[model samples]
Target chain A: MALNRKVGFFKGLKYKGGGPMWAWILHRLSGLAMVFFVGSHIIAGFLTQQFGSDVGIAINIVYENWIFQLVLFFLVIFHAVNGLRVTLLDLWPALLEYQRESIWLEWLVIIPLYVLILFTVLKSALGL
Target chain B: MQKITLKLFRYNPETDTKPHYDTFELEAEPTDRVLDLMEKVKGYHDGSLSFRRSCAHGVCGSCAMRINGQNMLACKTLVQDLKTSRITVEPILGLSVLKDMIVDMDPFFDSYKKVMPFFVNDEPKPAQERHQSIEDRERFDDTTKCILCGACTTSCPSFWSNDEYIGPAAIVNAHRFIFDSRDKGAAERLQILNDQFGVYRCRTIFNCTVACPREIQITQAIGEVKKAIATGSLD
Candidate 1:
């Protein structure tokens, strides 16, 4: 039953394509993720500020870990790319079809760039 | 005195197997309404055709249907004013077609109900008709002008995606009560509307404003809801 369900999920994913519907779903998902990250970042910043010049110490204590830094980096990149796409679509709805194509292009550009940034951050963090 | 053709969408989910368009040619008067032409076609041509209309002056808002690819009150659309001689009339978008021109409005009404469209104050009602200042009442006046026409909601892409979205019409209605000084449920209403699929779903699409027959600035009302959500104050 689990294998069948996993196959059904992949099949659903395979049928999806770039369109207004897809853009809307992506926008909502990205917005939710971005809001969550921003909230946590703000709260962490506040905690650090309250704790004094240990600001770097505060950040290091929580986010100096590789996993957290990687997650934050990916979240920022995803939010920025999705936000740019939404801004374009909102400004000129006539370009909606073209924007759908550009969204895929953005993923192509963003995924590799993010991976590179993540690699660099991880390497420097580990002093590799 | 131009002869025009109207392609009317005809279907009955119970009786008909599929939807199709039936065209009718009429020598139309310049001032004749689309509703008038529909009446003529129904009376003379096809007795099986069906649609909704009442208070032909546009106030009732029961006559809203798609004309020439736009949601409009058929009674308000003058046949002569349309640029094309051939026009297509269909049911409003983002709705289930009940029959030829009628749609199932239960979904629309359900969204309104989800927003808790009535006042919810724990206090007893005042004996003297809870007096609110003119300025306080006028704040919600524009939103109150909504006639539940579904034009604004259908025009909204967000409502198109998620039919359960308490749409602009409902949000505007909720705003009516939320901003009312006498109505003490502002916080409760705000909590209901602050969900993921609530007022935040609106992407500030001006289509609602363009389609509103009552000239209500729906985008502005949605913006006000956003502001209210942000400030934690409906007033």
Candidate 2:
């Protein structure tokens, strides 16, 4: 893919410093997002299981949509990567000095991982 | 018994272009306090030297200044125990320097006042002093030991970022009243500290614990505040 202005912008956001202050801010943001999204996900799943065949129609209406799938995909990826970062920092005080570097690296790693996951989702969605 | 060298930061807002360090060589005794050395430097070496001290003891907590880059009570630190040929002293960090070894304490006290560091009891005080069980009183005893010293506050990194954090010293004081069974304003005080800049800002660095001259467990008090908030039991 050609590197466009949009890609450059996303890269800039991804590479921003993850110092202790930044880590704390991101940790809170990711945690809140995880709590809200995962809570809704569990509720929807439980409703689907309870309603059985009628719920398959509701599930198809929701899951067949690309926008909702993409949002959910990004949410899961963000929560996973940021959650791991928070866990590492909490467990290892010695890694504090390299927090900024590690944050940039996390974005570098997560972007590719998310891209692969997104590719898989699109393949399955289009039946390609 | 040995001669010691003191490197003291000197700045006079009224006259000096910028702050500078002045080194003084002095003969020291085993039991001599850091305050004693400062007094000697002011009276004999340079009469214009300025710093705050009262009671010549640790109780007043006014003599808190940076000794060898660490916040400590000048009156309580013994010269002989330092075991160093050279020592450096400066005013407390994260405060406006008023002059050499003197800082503006209004900001620190302002945080204390914001927390409303006073008792508010709905129950009328008994004609005899309000009686309390030893366990209940002990909860606040450590916090009450704070003598308004800037040591703990200055040592905290969170206070450096947010001047409004009510620092360790002030928060400990507020906790003293908040945890008291007789106090009625616990919820109000907790509300003031529940903001992004308040107790949540504390990263539990424990610098305040090491800096306290009275050996007050400042971090523990902050932890208790966290517990109170988490349990929704500030009342």
Report DockQ per prediction, comma-separated.
0.03, 0.02
lDDT scores in order: 0.75, 0.76
For candidate 2, write residues B1-235 as lDDT tens digits: 7798999988887777778899999998878989999999998999999899999878988999888767899999998777787989988777777888888888899988989898898787689988789989886888888988889888766676567677888788889999898888999998888877778777755567678898877766777787687778643
RMSD of 2: 14.2
Chain A TM-score of each candidate structure, as shown: 0.61, 0.60
Cα lDDT for residue B202, model 2?
Answer: 76
Poorest lDDT segment (10 consecutive residues) of candidate 2 chain B:
B155-164
Residue-level lDDT for A2 in candidate 2: 11
For model 1, residues A18-62, the per-residue Cα lDDT tens digits are 253355455666678767766766767776677655654565576
Docking class of 1: incorrect
What would the TM-score be for candidate 1 when compared with the true structure?
0.65
Per-prediction backbone clash count: 0, 0
Task: Compose the digit string of candidate 2's lDDT tens values, residues A1-128.
Answer: 11111222232233222243354455556677667756666666777777665565575576558767776677667667766865564444335435556668878878898898888888888887
**Residue A46, candidate 2: alpha-carbon lDDT:** 76
Candidate 2 off by > 4 Å: A1-128
Q: What value does the lDDT take at residue A9 in candidate 1?
A: 28
| lDDT, residue A104, candidate 2 | 87
